[model samples]
Target: MQVTKTALKRIVLNRLYDHLRTHYSVSLSRATFVNAEPEAHAVDAATAFRSDIEIEELQRALDRIDEGAYGTCIHCNAELPLEDIRKDPCKRICRGCEKFVF
Candidate 1:
């Protein structure tokens, strides 16, 4: 089962859309943002920014797929298991090397 670039792009876009929809709904809710203080709003903004960053990272992963680097563990250059890749589309390391990634 090959992971094509189109498949990866769809995954990234789906996640991005999910994230934005959730955030937008929260921001629109009267109870969540309307009553929040300045510090609380700042925290919410930071959280949203982090989620955006993760989505961007997934986009980079999709780009790597386009570059013919997907499924290869970045740490070991070994082909990552298809099962793991399917389970976590953003994975960059195999189970054995995952602990050492950070």
Candidate 2:
């Protein structure tokens, strides 16, 4: 039996929830090549910035759920298989139409 799209949406929501719970922090480099030494704080800040980008994408995926547009290809406007969406929440292609994307 195949899982319904609504169930997959719940899974996606759970994943996003888990990711939000974990706190990932980046560290800074102390030795600078050009200057006297790189500050450790600089490295940590950069890590946080990268993590922010991930969070932004997560928010976008969540928005798709709210829009009732999850598991559908944005390009072809076709419903992607629930299994595919479950494996990759960010995937935007159905199996048959995926070839065109490449």
Candidate 3:
């Protein structure tokens, strides 16, 4: 059976939880980056940046859902396929208008 939008939303919520956990993990503490070696600091910054992006994307997804625009391509207004949504509930653009993969 085809999955419903509510199910897709739940998937996004679950992923948001995972990203939040990673962003707040004890081992990835921001305080440790303050006195770490240059390489370690760089890694920490990169990790933090990635986590931030992930969290933002998930939040945007939730917003889009509330707007009744989830699974709709933001760039071209195309309807994103259910398969794509299943693959990534946070995706906001369709493949045709996609300029970057992340």
Candidate 4:
């Protein structure tokens, strides 16, 4: 199904909220540090770090949506395929640019 700009905006916003919630829940505090076992604390720390990155990226996507740039390839300024956006709403580049960048 072809996703509209509105849908993409909603998806990004939802993802941003979810990531922020998870990050906050997992990040270590003094209480958590005292209570968590070493291995579990380490794992939570790693997960929190990944969630932090995702939150940043998703926030950028929301900014792009507000700026009328969402779903466009950042490198080429082409409209990204709806399928690609549906598959990964946080993706900022099109498949073609993705090949060159990585």
Candidate 5:
């Protein structure tokens, strides 16, 4: 079944909120591990860092949706295929941009 843009927006919002919650929990756990287990603390810190980045990206995606640019490439302004967006809501660049960057 093809997903409507509204549905895709909802999915992306849900995922963003979920990630925010996960990031908070990871941060709490990281704080606890700071003095108890150095290795675990480092791992949790890294996870929290990555989660923070993802949260930012998802927020930008939400903003793009509000601006009617959710499925458009940020670099080339190309319309991103729905399948690609479905696979990764945080994607902001088209395949062409990806190739150009690499």
Candidate 6:
């Protein structure tokens, strides 16, 4: 409820766009770069792994949006700051719980 309807819409759109971009990156890295040189392949694999993580986060964000819990931390249930949401709409935990998560 902290975010206005208009802002929620914008956040959703941004998350969706980021999801698409990250998915494409993962696909490209796995397919086209899989047969590259040894060092390049390692880097591409790492990039793809990071992209996979991002894809998961984006999906969770969409799910939380659908459930009307987008701007709240899943860990502590604290209302996430609007600025934090603006920076990373897919964030699931607040800064406080973030330390323990990783």
For model 2, where is the 10-residue window of minimal lDDT? 29-38
Best by TM-score: 4
Could you tell me how far off, in angstroms, the CA of residue 31 lies in candidate 3 after the best superposition? 31
Question: Candidate 1 has which clashing residue pairs, if any?
Answer: none
Model 3 CA deviation exceeding 4 Å by range: 1-3, 25-51, 99-102
TM-score of each: 0.57, 0.56, 0.57, 0.59, 0.59, 0.54
lDDT of each: 0.59, 0.55, 0.62, 0.63, 0.62, 0.59
Residues 1-102, model 3: lDDT tens digits: 255556665666556545555656544443333233323443335345454677677657766776677888888888888778767878778998886643
lDDT of 4: 0.63
Flag clash pairs in model 4.
none
Clashing pairs in model 2?
27-43, 27-44, 28-43, 28-44, 31-38, 32-38
Model 1 bad stretches (over 4 Å): 25-51
Give the lowest summed-lDDT range of ten residues in model 4: 30-39
Please say which candidate is ahead in TM-score: 3 or 4: 4
Clashes of each: 0, 6, 0, 0, 0, 0
| 1-102 per-residue lDDT for model 4 (tens digits) | 356555676666555445545556644344444343323544345345564567667657766776777888889988888778767878879899989999
- lDDT tens digits, residue span 1-102, model 5: 355555666666556545655655544432333233212444335345564677667657756776677787889888888778867989879998999887
User: Model 5 TM-score?
Assistant: 0.59
Candidate 4 vs candidate 6: the lDDT winner is 4
Question: When superposed on Cα atoms, how far off is each prediction in RMSD?
Answer: 10.2, 12.8, 11.2, 10.7, 10.7, 11.1
